[model samples]
Target: MAEESRKIIHVDMDAFYASVEQLDNPELKGKPLAVGGGGARGVVAAASYEARKFGVHSAMSGQLARKKCPELIFVSPRFNRYREISHSIREIFFEYTDLVEPLSLDEAYLDVSQNKTGMPSATLLAREIRQRILKTTGLTASAGISVNKFLAKIASDVNKPNGQKTIPPEEVHDFLMQLEVRKFFGVGKVTAEKMYRLGIFTGADLHSKDEDFLTTHFGNSGAHYYKVVRGIHNSPVQPSRIPKSIGAERTFRENLSSEIFMLEKLEGIAEELEKRLGSKDRAGKTITLKIKYSDFQLQTRSHTGGHFVSKKAEILAIARELLYQQPLRESVRLLGISLSNLNTEQDSSAPAAEDVSVQLRFDF
Candidate 1:
């Protein structure tokens, strides 16, 4: 089974949030548009290609984005409408195979080794799915077809914003050897810097290292890197698709040096997060606060309490306290508030008082 060829496809919506805004407001099409909560403290949700040309991008502060692109238009995110479109896309996928693993509202991975449609070629299946998405939802999606998730994900971006690419088995080696190390999964800013310092700037450089040497430097993650460098990734496609939590955050245009500014940002994030939780009819026992410094250093603190917290005030209070407790040398450039340890079973559906007090443990 491990040696057999696998049929994997990665589908990603093009400029998802910004595109949705343009779709609903036809006049905004082909213009620079940014989807974000509008406030001095709000963060960008997405930036259109015209906006990108001006250096505007997601996670950027609205103020900075405006400075970069003075004509950048801001539109608020409409998640319900986005969700409606997402559901339609999911329905299209189910027509081909149930082995669809959604990464988010805008991206998914499908395993079509043995598809419901009895298709012999995964590339053909990818094209059909892309066409169906466009016919049904007035939107464009890019797809990548390969033998595994890693290759498929990279191939998908080769020709983006409404394009498809395929990497057959014969071309896998040449494709991987020339691939940049930064494009490898799990290699973010910090990891990429470390790889560069070690003279492993590309996949070819990484492949030249002894596996044991990589393990010594990076532990378990190094093993992942080593295998990927050799074009060997066997992770399974997971499709159960239940979200464990939901949250939102923002990055400041300039470093936030004052508590007043930070708290204000936290309040807006908490409000948005609570709205999402309320819509899902979910509550969480754990609240987490994430901070990222200007240097890209990141830290997080989480608290698990007895009460299920769904109120904005409660979340903000906890986040503020966490922010205060952190020892800082540099000003914070980004702030994130999240809730986990979720209890999604309906409160009414739960057991009696004694049962309500019972704690469930997951061994995984």
Candidate 2:
């Protein structure tokens, strides 16, 4: 299949966790709300649009969120309910195309170049998918339609929270050229600042740099930047996504200065991690311990053994070893445990070779 002929759509649920909370309880619908892992020390997992109006958002500390939106309501996360809803959403995606690559519980990329419904236009498919998802889940979704994933993903955010955007093949070049560098998917705060320092503030500026100069500054990702700026991202939509690691973490109500308190928290985190591994029927040789200090400084220590550990005792033991391996830099507020290099990591079986022929004239 030619790159220009591909039709990709990125479907993103609007404020998914907060929306679910709003759906389950009528009182939270119109109020400023933050769905959190827990209250007090926990970070905002998701913020309702009402909360966002006051500059509240996910990963904002609860303390700050409260200051920003004094009337904000904090609710505990319900993973089981979120997963049940996510499964239903995935079912909706599979109804249209098998080439769905889920980025998380709330967003996914789909290749409907050859759709199950024989729909010639990808824009209509996106509208119908969003409509179906709303009818089925009572939740709204936004979509982006384009020739490839990169354009589609960015487009999804342009008109958000129940809106959709399309960037057809012909307009992709100009669309990318005028785009701000900060709007690029992987360009976070640090990267955006660096790009600013380098005078690469827009796609046009990025396209002005050679691959060598980009590689010199951005390492391996420079090559990727060089490709995406010209609307040249060609990575296929991988349906068989693999988990790189599995982990669980918890935030404490107060920062603990004692290692004993840290160890006690590790036990519970390990127990949650053990259940997660069991659910996936997975175990790995690598165990990592993550720490967040009172000042929000984050650190991680990892150890990989020859043997894999799936049980609670073994996981807790390794986590304990990692905890003691380094002295506390500061009073800690968060702890986590994770496993990687799983048994599921094996030689890649090739994705099915296929062909696609779609109408190149997409109406964005």
Candidate 3:
């Protein structure tokens, strides 16, 4: 028998944190608002549509955001409340389809080709799901329906808040061919510039390049570019996607030049890492150390162990080696550590903890 055609829907909440705040507080409606920490080093976590008009966006520094929109009201994020609402929304999704893949607390992809309601139209199902989310959580969501994940995800962004878009399989090729190269999933600013120089500015241009040409120019990613331009993405909506890495990072108020001070800061970061690992009961074989210089140059060093390391001593041992092996080029402003190649399976034995109170007596 021939295989069944796929139906994927990507659901994204509209400015989730800001919308939740507006729903809970009547006065915040129709005003420009941002949910974030408000300080010298603070960053915006979410921005309302009204705020977005002035070029405010997430990950932008609060200082610059204020400069862009002086009236932007900043509110601290209520993570617990957001999580509660996200749980309610997920329950609604499961009512329609068990094949749900959560991208974050406020977004997910659902395979609704074979749904609980036995509905044959994925577009109608998307509308129903959006309406249910609004009715249940008092917050609106946007949706995109397509034959695969990539197109569906992009479609969700077409009609802003509280809207849905569906791309029939028959229209997929035309839709992609007319789309801009910069709009493709993995294409960023640098890649777009390279494409422009190579005279590949649109999806049609990307499609025109042969597999060998793309591969020779872009390495492995060229293959992905070649396939996606033709609407050939087949990656599934995985329901059990585990996190590949966990990390903690901090930006200092003052750049430090002393190796002694940097090591002290790294020790605090390692302790936090241990606590996080213990909470998740996860260990990883790879340890990475990241640093940002005062001039904004970034550098990283990593080492992979034979076995997983989650305990404080084990993490610090590898982290310390990575730090000392590289000499500082300038004053450092940011530092971070991460663990990857994780072991998420339940381990029968408990991780042993040890204290290593070594002072920074040596200098590079």
Candidate 4:
């Protein structure tokens, strides 16, 4: 089975955006820098290692970051330049194997089980790829080598900033058992909090729970929790891991009772979805609308057999329709729109751009 024989390597760029800016401009090197427009409303896009030392990080409010590090140097993100470097790294990965699954502009999963170079060891290949990225892009990358995607991704993060780690097949269970539940891929802040309240703080705690019990508590994702706790993921390293859906949701600072305001927020989300679909050369047959109400209750509505929707107007129209079909039972805090049943061929035909798209589907 390709799943069982999989040789996955997770490659992560070190401080991707910030590193690129520093590389191109010597003045920014060895300084605390963040990539984003700096203002009261602006947030950090990428933080240099120096800035990280000051506890600054991406998605942190720009105003808050300024308060944390008063001397922080702010630079607007050069996405075009970052994309250029991302492209270069993508080419380098393909040179080793075409089974490349990019997670983001700065990270990717490469399945080199059967590589172009006929390399028998994926670890050696990961080392070579890291070196090549440094030479060509003037940037450092970290890598993790394992038999599966889950272990490989965790290994990559274990050694930070220009390092590599490997977890052998025999050590998978032990490695996972020692990990904190919060560090698990699928465990977000909300989920982690729930797990904490349940007295499950580590992978070991999760492993102790029966599969049926977890499923009863966490729903479908609980089954995933059971497998990941034992390092038993069976998902493949898909070569064309294209976006099957595009959607955005916001957790409200305060829950809204107005249906009109919720619809207005959905409009913004629809526009964002439209732009994303237009930017990527793919069409979808399904439009899914998700709403999370104030009580944390979640529900999704989807429409199928839709047109080859590439334009925002069409996508929004469908999403709006699906959204209205359901009643808001409680005050809503989050809304999202997604297009699924993808057309991969459309994406492959697009002009190749760099910066791997890293999609962290923690739900598996």
Which one is best on TM-score?
Answer: 3
Off by over 4 Å in 1: 37-39, 242-288, 292-298, 302-325, 329-364
Q: Which stretches of candidate 3 lie over 4 Å from their true place?
A: 1-4, 253-257, 292-299, 324-333, 344-364
How many pairs of residues collide in each model?
Answer: 0, 0, 0, 7
lDDT of each residue in 1-364, candidate 1, tens digit only:
1355578899999898898888889999999999995466667989998899999999887888888988889998899999999999999998888889999899999999888988788888899999999898888999998877898999999999889998887777778789889999889988899889999888888889988989998888987887777667776677885566778888777788787888899999999999989998878888999888876678898888898998899999998888888676588888898888787643666653211110112110
**Regions more than 4 Å wrong, model 4:** 1-3, 247-337, 341-364
Residue pairs in steric clash, candidate 3? none
Candidate 4 residue-pair clash tally: 7
**Clash pairs, model 2 backbone:** none
lDDT of 3 at 217: 89
Cα lDDT of model 3 by residue, 1-364, tens digit: 2233788899999999999999999899999999996677677999999999999999877888999999999999999999999999999999998999999999999998789998888888899999999889999999998877989999999997899998887778888988999999899988999999999998898999999999998898898898788776776788887788898888898888988898899999999999998898989999999998876678999999899899888888888899899689999988999999899743548753232111112110
Please give each candidate's TM-score: 0.77, 0.86, 0.87, 0.78
Order of all candidates by lDDT, from best down to worst?
A: 2, 3, 1, 4
- Top-down TM-score ranking: 3, 2, 4, 1
Can you write out model 4's per-residue Cα lDDT over 71-185, one digit (the tens) per residue?
9999999889989999999999999988898888999999887889987877788899999999998899999988778889999998988999988776777888889998887
RMSD of each: 9.0, 3.5, 11.3, 7.8
Query: What C-alpha lDDT do the candidate models reach, one value each?
Result: 0.84, 0.90, 0.88, 0.82
Model 3, residue 237: what's the lDDT?
80
